[model samples]
Target: MTSDRVPVVVAARRTPIATKGARLAHVTAEHLAAPVIRACVDDARAATGARADIGDVVLGNCMGPGGNIARLAALAAGIDVAVPGMTVDRQCGSGLSAIITAGEAIRAGDDRLQLAGGVESASTAPTRTFAGIAYFRAPFAPSGFPDPEMGPAAQALALRYDIDRHQQDNYAARSHQLAYDAHRLGRFDEEIVAIGDVRVDDGPRAGIPAMLGRFAPLFAPADGELNGTVTAGNSCRISDGAAAVAMVPAGSRGTTPGLALVAAATVGCDPALPGIGPVAAITRALADAGVTLADVAAFEIVEAFAAQTLAVLHLLGLAPDGVADPRVCAQGGALALGHPWGASGAVSVVRLFSRLVRGNAPAGTLGIATAAVGGGMGVAALFKVVR
Candidate 1:
């Protein structure tokens, strides 16, 4: 098998986020995934001017009962019945995992053109529900790995990293500032498709509230043991959104060659501290790519919580404030943009690719996208600017 980095190209990308009008009121669940898929395929076809048929479609979705969402989405996109489709779930890493799987398939000479990404209409998807007591007891009785709830996990990370509530609020404030700046500068125009004529992101507000006022800790004890640090002000808001990216073999004839996926890595952490998974994953990815954090031109760390981002930065020895890079999600992150579970990671990748192409940043520019899952699992992928 060829060990050379599989030259995988991001042929196209698209994101349909509800940026205006009642939050998440723009899109329906059944139609949400299909439009993004179609938009991505259309963009890829236009960019490459090649009628390359997608050999397979892999969708990352966390919720939904028994619907074969991947196949349904493909069919809705007018894809031929011959094309195969499959859905996968890896918690928050599902989107990144789909991309990795597609890239590996192409590298292994199994498929050439692949549609890989994720979608989540949080407004429609059902929340996590435990069945009967027997089902719950079966897993833990035998010492099965427990899925740490996101809230407690974030609280634990804040405690371990010593991230104060004020600091987390500050980080959240900066995220809003950056996102606002990006939107004002039209940085997000490339990948953010207006759903039903909505233009700008409506979720991000103009002025970020300072953390001087007293607010209850999200998961702290009632006795006020200084245990509560994670706050709604610093956490990602639940949102409804969908994103998709088209991948093709690199070096394929095209007018505008898309961004290239250079490398990807996923790592597991102590389930007790699920939010720090990205820290380990990012370290592994940088090492694998032989690039330091300084070499990355832009980063799109999923803002699951301000504390999570701060903890990862502290762990990586990055600027505690935030990366000074101009392309780091100039349009804001999951905080301001809203975290739509399965779609957030893919949305970050699409935004990164848009920045690389539209900004015409330096050659070999590195874009890092990371996401932390519910069980202390995280995934990071590195992309190289290839215009």
Candidate 2:
């Protein structure tokens, strides 16, 4: 794709993340996504002073009903019926992947605008069964490859990377505290779309640090010499939420400050160590964007599990503190905001928009949004602030 047709994120918004079986438990995936989509489109229209000629609506979703949820959400959002919709599934990476897909379409010279993002409603997901038997998850790989569950993979990563329980708990605590502080200050107010009574994210809390030792390890080593360090407190809560962005070509930016798509990369790693995928993907993405880790002013990597996040940080040489890093998820992450599987990646981008664009950072400021996907893959997108 040519750089001249770069896709600019003209508007971004997300629903308040609610933990599974909480206030948003009854909301369906389409319903959760529709309002966010509508808000983004409305924001873009308000800026351009004309109705957007929507080319398509792209959404990432996992474990929703079998129908095309993107189409359902687009229609529910009141978009023109002529616009088509597409759904993509890249496990946890789905949201970022969808955004990248829309950006690529714009970069390929599609003059019409695009609406893209992801949504998930784990609380209202349909049960899955195969051949008269129930299954918790579909296989990530063929029988010959290792396909460890997310929790065990995180445990193995923590043990392999020497991330101790204390470090994990401290990181989790920091995430919760940051999110709580940001909310109290109304930092997230501009980006959040209220749904019913859920105007604020319900996952973050202030007292997590004091209660660190209460959680027992959910995954432990069989030898018992080193007990499992992964716990519920440090891991992300399953949630229901959606995040979306309105993308237009650079010429259509119309004096709005936005994140211009710079470069993106998706890569694969060993399935047994899926959390490590970000290290390779981020490296390649930075190289592709002609920048280094030091050049990035903001990092919004999904906090699926503290150990996993710490492992990625340690591998990337960004989190020497282990417990806190001001540049990474400065306002907190999925650990405190709740991880709505498919929506978490897009939430990372929305967070970046809030941090870099909405905050009025100087033009050319660099940021990145990345996520470790299930099945041994990672997706990373490099963005730069533009006015």
Clashing pairs in 2: none
lDDT of 2 by residue, 1-387 (tens): 556599999899999999999999999999999999999999998977767699999999988985999999999999889999999999999999999999999988898889999999999998889999988779988899999999999998988888999999999998999999999999999999999888999868888778878998898753466579999999999999999999998887778889998999999999999999889989999998789999999999999999999999999998796755579999999999999999988999999999999999999999999999989999999999998
The ten-residue window of minimal lDDT in model 2 covers 219-228
Structural similarity to truth (TM-score) of each candidate: 0.89, 0.98
Off by over 4 Å in 2: 222-226
The regions of model 1 sitting more than 4 angstroms off are 1-7, 19-28, 127-146, 197-199, 210-215, 221-227, 253-255, 321-328
The superposed Cα distance between candidate 2 and the true structure at residue 322, in angstroms, equals 2.3
Q: Please state the error at residue 327 of candidate 1 in Å.
A: 6.4
Give per-residue lDDT, candidate 2, residue 4.
56
lDDT of 2 at 204: 89
